[model samples]
Target: MGYDIMKNNNTKRLAVSLLLIFPLLVFGQKRVEAKADRLFQKRAYALAADEYEDLLKHNWNTAYAHKQLAFCYFETREFDKALPHLQEVLGNDDLPLRYIWEYALLLKAEGKIEESEKWLAYSKMIKLKNPLIPRLSQDSTWHPVALLERQEYKVEPVSFNSKYSDFGARIYNDTLYFTSSRKTPENNSNYSWYDEPYLDLYYIPLSSLDQTPKALEGGIRSKYHESSPTFFKDYKGKNSVFFTRNNLKSGQYVVGKKRINNLKIYKGEQKKNGTWDMSRDLAINSPDYSNAHPF
Candidate 1:
C-alpha cells in the first residue's frame, strides 16, 4: 500500500532505510524537509519516494511533495508513478525548463507522440521574462556557430513520420532523405533489439511535404538495412549516394567469426532512369567494426 520501490526480491532497501533513518535521528527532524529532502539530497531516491508519498497522503505541502516525489520516481526510473506526479509539478510556473524536456521524453516513452512533440516544442519558449545575460559579443559581431547552445530554437514534427521511429533527416537537391523503421515491402527484416522493422532510407519532396515519403529502391535499398544517406548531386554527371548497410556475403547478411555483423559503407551513382547501381565498397570499411553515416 506504499511507495516502496525496491523490488520484493531485494534486502538492500531495508539496509538503506536504516541508514537513512540514522541521519534523521542525529539531526533531530523538525519538518518534512528533514525527512524526505535529506534522503533526496543523499541520493537515496527509493527511500525518499516513500516519505514524499506519505506527505502527499497527509496533504502537507502537496506541491513540494509532488515535486520531490516525481523526481524520486524519475531517478528510480519508475515512470508510471513519475508521470502523474510530474504532471502536478508542471502546474508551477517556476518549474525549470529541463523538467518540461523530461516530461516530453516520458510522454514519448509512453507512446503519446503528438503530445510529447507539443511539449517538446513548447520547451523553447522564454521561461525567464528578463534574462540578465546579454547575448551580443565583440561589438555586435556574430557568427552562426558561436554560442549556439545559448540560442533559442523551436522544435516541430515533420509531416513524414512513422509511429515507430524516423530520424537522421538530411536535405539534398530539394528532397529530404532520412532513416525510418517503418515496414516496407522490400524491407522484410527486423532489428531484434527493438522488435521493429529494419531501417531503410526514405525521401520526400520539399515542395509537397504533406505527401507520404517514397522509399529509395534499386541498389540503394537492401533486404537488411539502408540508412544515413549522403547525396552528391553531380558525381561525373550523375547523382551519387553514400550510405550504411549490413555486411552482405553473396546476398546474405554476413556474420564474422565472432558472430558479430557490422554495418559497411557503400557508394552508388544514379542512372539516367533515376534508378541506382551499386558502385564500389568504401575501402575504409573493416570486417571487424562498423562504418556508418558517410558524408
Candidate 2:
C-alpha cells in the first residue's frame, strides 16, 4: 500500500511538470509564428522561410504554416524546398489556383511527368479559384510551341551558364547574347524579390565559344534587370539593339499600380565606339504594365 502511494505521487509530480511547461511551449510557438507572419507581410520572404522552417522542424505542423512556408520558398525561388510544404497544403479546400499550378509545374520540373499531369487534370476537375489561368496558359502556348516539331536544329546548352537564372537568349551577327543573374564581385545589386543579383546582359562571340562570356561592353548594365537583347537597324539605318529593362523614373525604382516594377523595351543606338546611348524606353511602353521582347 505504501509503495502504491509513492507511485501515484510520482505520477502526480510528472503531470504537474507537464502542466507547468505546456503554456511555455504554446507561447514559444505563438511567438515564432507571429514573427514569421510579420516578416511575410513585409515581403521578407527569406527571413519568413527561416522562421516557418524552424516552427516546422519543431513539429508544429499546421496547414496555414505549411502553406505560408510554401509561399515563402516559392517567392525566394527555392522550389525544391517548397515542394514538401506545398504537398502538405494540397488538401486545403481554400487553396489558390496559383499554388496548384505551381505544384504541377514543380512536379514537371523535377521530372515527375505523370504526377504533374495528374495534378493538372485534378486542377481541372476542382472548383478552380482562378479559372482564367487555364485559358491564359493555353492561349499563351500556341504560338511558342506550334513549330517545335518543325524545327530540326539540335538544341545545345551554352557553355557559360552559371548555377543561376540564365535565359532569354538570342543570336545576332555571330554573337550570342543572353540574360543571366550570375554573381560577380563588382555587381552587388540584387533583385528585390530574392537574394540573387539582378539580371544583366552577357554575350559570347560564336567564334570564341570556348572563352568566358563577357558583359555587354557599355554602361548598359543597370541596377535592375537588363534582358532580351535583339540586334536590328533603326529608322535612320543605324545599327541598334533593343533590350528589356525595368521602368525607372528619375533614376529611382518605380512601382506600378500593381506595386510591381514592370519591364519595358529600351532602344540603344550603337555608337561608333560600340558603347550605347542613354535609355530610351520605347513609346509602346506604359508604366501601368509590362512591355518586352522586341524582335
Candidate 3:
C-alpha cells in the first residue's frame, strides 16, 4: 500500500508517487506556473515537474518552483534527480521543515551517511516528528560486519493474484484476508492518483485454496478503499476485526475541491452467526490524518 497521503494546499508534508507529461504552450511564465500548480493539485507529479522545469529554463526560477520540482522527482522515486533541486532551496528560510527531512533522506539514499546525519540532526532541532532521527542517532556508532555464510531460500509467486495491485496479506485462523485494487464488473471507479480501482478487502479459506476469493459482506466493503484487515481477541474475549477505511461522514469520502479522504481505523464485532458488525469508527481515528495498518 502507498505509505504517505498528500494533503491539500501544499501546506502539509507527505511522501510521493505517479507522474505524467504535459505540453509547453507558447504562453507566459505565469501561465506555465499556473498549469504546474494545477497539475500538482491534481496529483500529476510528472507533468508538474516538466512544467516546473520549463519555467526554470525560461529564467522564471523561484523557491516554489524548485521545491515543487524536487517533490515531483521524490514522488516518482527519482531520488538522484530530487537531491539537487532540494539542495537549491534548502538554504532558503521560506522552505518548509518537511523538505529538510527529505533532503536528509535523499542523502542517506545516495550513501552519504555523514551528510545525512548532519541534516537529520538539524531537522530534529526543528522538532519535526521524523522516525529516522532517533534511529540514525541510535545506530550512529554501529558498523557493518562481513558475513561468512549465506542462507539458501526458495521464492515462488502465489497463483491467486490478478493483474492489478494485490498485497497486504494477513492470516487469521483458517481464512487468509488481503487487500486488492482489482476491478470488478460491479464496480469500476478508479482512484485519480494511480488510475487504479479503489482497494477492497477479500478473503479465501485456507483449507479451500482452489476456491475463488470473495469480498467481505455486511457493509464491510464500501465504494471507497477498505484495506489492512486485522483480527484480534477483544477485551471481553469476543472476536474483533480492525481495518483501514477512508474517512466517511455523510456517505461521501471526497469533499470540496481538495478531494481529501484521510484514512482511519474501523472496528467490527463478530455476531452470533459469524458475520461482522462493523458500525463504529475507533476513537483513535482522525479526520485530518491517516491511521493505517492496525495490528
Candidate 4:
C-alpha cells in the first residue's frame, strides 16, 4: 500500500512540474521579442522581422505583435505581411492613430476601396491639435484621394505646343493668365532651361460667347518658370496676383506678387532688367514637397 501511494505522488508531482515549465517557455519567447524590438529601433527591419517570427511561434499576443511586425515589414517593403497586420488592426478599432492612416493608405493602394474608406472614417476621428490636418487636402499624399471625390468634375481637354507641363488656371476680369514652357529666340540652341525665352508666361483673353467659353492669347510675358498662380482678393475690393518663380541658379522656387492691369497671362522669365524681385515661395509650402498646384 505504501508503494502504491508513492507512485501516485510522483505522478502528481510530474504534472505540476510540466505546468510550471510551460509558462516559462512562454515567457522565454519574450526575450526573442525584446531582441526583435531592439533591432527594429535600430532600423534593421529585416533582422527584426526574423526575430519576430520566432516570437510569433509562441503565439504571444498575436494581434499587437502582428501589428508591430507589420510595421517592420512595411519599413522593409515587405508589403504582404504588413497588410495582414493592418487588416487585423482595421477589424479592431482601438488601433493607434499613426498606424491607422498607414494602414488605410496601404489598403487604398491595394485597391481595397471599401475597406480603406472604412478605416479612413475611423482615422478622421483622431484629430491633430495642429490646424494642418485640414490643410493636408492640398498635399500630394492626399491628392489622389481628393481626385477620387471629384467624380462630377467637368473635364475639358486643352493642349498647347510648349513643353510647359505644370499648369494652373485662373479667371479674372474677363482675362486668363497662364504659365507655359516655350523657348525665347535669344536662347541658345543648347539653351539653359531657365534662361530660355520659352520659359516666359503667356495669356489669352475671354470674349463674349452666348454660352461657350473661349480662351484667347495676350502677347505679354515673364522670363522664368512662373508656375503656380493664385488670386488674392483683399477685404477692400482690390485684387492682386501671387505666383511662384523658379530661380535658375539656386534651383529653388519662390513666391512673389505683381500688379497686372489687363489680367493677361504671363509665363515666368528673368526680365532684361533682372527684376526677379517680384516673386517668393510661400511659407506654407513644404520645401521637400512641392506646392505647385493652384486652385
Which residue ranges in model 4 land beyond 4 Å of their true spot? 1-7, 91-94, 126-295
Better of 1 and 3 by TM-score: 3
Give per-residue lDDT, candidate 1, residue 180. 92
The global Cα lDDT (0 to 1) of model 1 is 0.72
Candidate number that wins on lDDT, 1 or 2: 2
C-alpha lDDT (0 to 100) for residue 124 of candidate 3: 73
Worst 10 residues of 3 by lDDT: 142-151
Count of backbone clashes, every candidate in sequence? 0, 0, 0, 29
Ranking by lDDT: 2, 3, 1, 4
Residue pairs clashing, model 1: none
**TM-scores, all models, native as reference:** 0.50, 0.72, 0.59, 0.42
Clashes of 3: 0
What order do candidates take by TM-score, descending? 2, 3, 1, 4
Model 3, residue 295: what's the lDDT?
77
Candidate with the larger lDDT of 2 and 4:
2
Winner by TM-score: 2
Q: What would the TM-score be for candidate 2 when compared with the true structure?
A: 0.72
Per-residue alpha-carbon lDDT of candidate 4 for residues 87-139, written as tens digits (9 for 90 to 100): 76666656666666666666666666677666565556655233433344233
lDDT of 3: 0.75
Question: Which segments of model 2 are wrong by more than 4 Å?
Answer: 1-48, 58-61, 72-78, 104-155
Task: Report RMSD (Å) for each prediction in the order shown.
Answer: 14.4, 5.2, 14.6, 15.8
After aligning candidate 3 to the native by TM-score, how far in Å is the CA of 30 from where it should be? 2.9
Which 10-residue span in candidate 1 carries the lowest summed lDDT? 132-141
